[model samples]
Target: MLIGDVARRSGVSARMLRHYDALGLVRPTGRSHAGYREYSSKDIQRIFHIESLRSLGLSLREVRRALEDPSFTPAELVADLIRQTRERIAAETELLTRLRRIDAVEPSGWEDVFQIVALLQALGSKSAGKRQSAALSSVDDVPLPVEALVEAALSESDPNVAGALRWALAQSGEESLALLAEGLGSPAAEVRARAVQSIAEMPNDGATTLLREALTTPDLVVRRHAALALGVRGVADAVPTLIDMVVEGTNDVDAADALSALATRPASAKRIATKLADRLAEDGVEPPARRRLTQALADIPGPTASKALTDLSHDEDREVALTATYILGLRAAR
Candidate 1:
């Protein structure tokens, strides 16, 4: 078959066919004696596969790699491609839903928009899977109906629509929690941090467990966010972990946040102050470690911490003395 026949069967233009051939991605099966290109049925089949993969959102490079590597299973490649597409679609759908919800309301349309707003709020509270399904169910084909409802509400100036948008923004679900758990494995540290933060907002034993597990992450950002989340959740179970972070974590911000969280309880405050005082009194404690311990003690803000800081005011390190003095001043104010 000629290039025209390949184009017709593959639904790709002749020019793109030549481009694919030039890239060595779907070469012709044979050549005529006159030096013309010749494609066999096998070549057409290859083109179809390439097109199918492209439709599924694989880049040409990814397609080429999957095609050229014999060890790469087609099913695995397709599955990965599908997952990527789903993530993209999910993000897009969320953005569209927000936009539509904003546009759906009218001021003069109804005396009370509370019912519609409540429904939208309930919809938003559902898991992402449920939300996605609800959005899709409202439309014939496109996934924009939820957004359309929002848009209608916004346009009509309905108070219910405004309430719905706020509710959705605050919505939490198991699916969202699962998405966050999956993000913990992302290569980006920021993504992992955000995932942990989101999970902390929702009330779930599983979510808390995931946040606790994140405390052990090698990434300081992830560990920092986990500590902050644990504090926000006010989980007493996390106090020990947060204390460890204050004692040993590389990130000062994280340590500060953890110490602040731990300071909320008198028992925790006393415990942390005692630990810091012991560290300061140790002959073998390094200067830097000692300094960090002093800073954490000062941050705890109590009689025990203030007393420890006052004693440290006479230390050899001028910075430590100054910090201790500052802590004394802060404690005096209280």
Candidate 2:
């Protein structure tokens, strides 16, 4: 076919097609009698593959390398692409987090803030993680000061303050975990919720029991945190209980946490996904729930989970539409 035909079919401009040819990214299958380039169906397939990789965040150079070598497996190329995309996402998340902290700082103390800003500028040349760690370490270790900060964090109604405290505590390791768990037993519901999250980060028997007990706590926030903690733990034992909570419970927060936790166990996740698909077939489950279940299936990595998610992606529900797309991307990466 002519360049126009390839451009129309591939949604890539004619100029790009010629540029790709120049870069040897995609060459014609043959040449016409008049020496014009002739692209066959196979060429179009290559174009489509390139387009897909580009959409997934691969640069032209990276895509060209993958295409040049026939020995390069699709799985390997997709894995590299996914790794790059994840790194980009992590960097962007960290930048956004820093911006949020900067925005929260008061503007009244201009002189001191400006001096600190200049110092930060010098430190910013280092890695973000390193800079953050250095800044935290520079603070005085007086117990009263730390306690006051913790108290302020606990009393503050803002989620952002809670999140910042969580992040800071997470970086402190065991001490942070101990502090958060202690906070959970405090009078403030917000403090308890934050503590539950910190407990979830601790992958020990003590943390597990704490989470389990929190599930039965009187406070809704505590119960919700327990469910979240269980999910993050990815413990197989929690799966059945979470499933029961989903099926028999009326609390949306609990149900959401159960679903999140259920998605972490590979074995139980597959079982639950299959059960959800069966329920969908029977027309007994709600569309939103079915879609959430489908997404949960996709989130659990492995061939069995991928196959289940792929099947559910074709479900009539629009909510599950992206689940299939994500599952396919993961499968491709695998």
Please tell me which predicted candidate would have the highest TM-score against the true structure: 1
Candidate 1, which segments miss by more than 4 Å at Cα? 1-170, 187-190, 203-205, 236-254, 278-292
Tens-place lDDT digits, model 2, residues 66-159: 7777887889878887798899999999767545444444334666455444434433434444344433542423111233234434554445
**Model 2 TM-score on a 0 to 1 scale:** 0.40
**Residue 184 alpha-carbon offset, candidate 2, angstroms:** 3.4
| TM-scores for the candidates | 0.45, 0.40
Residue-level lDDT for 205 in candidate 1: 73
Determine which window of 10 residues in candidate 2 has minimal summed lDDT: 140-149
lDDT by residue for model 1 (231-275), tens: 767665555555556556466556566666767878877876777
Off by over 4 Å in 2: 1-150, 171-188, 201-209, 218-220, 237-269, 272-284, 302-334
Q: Which candidate tops lDDT?
A: 1
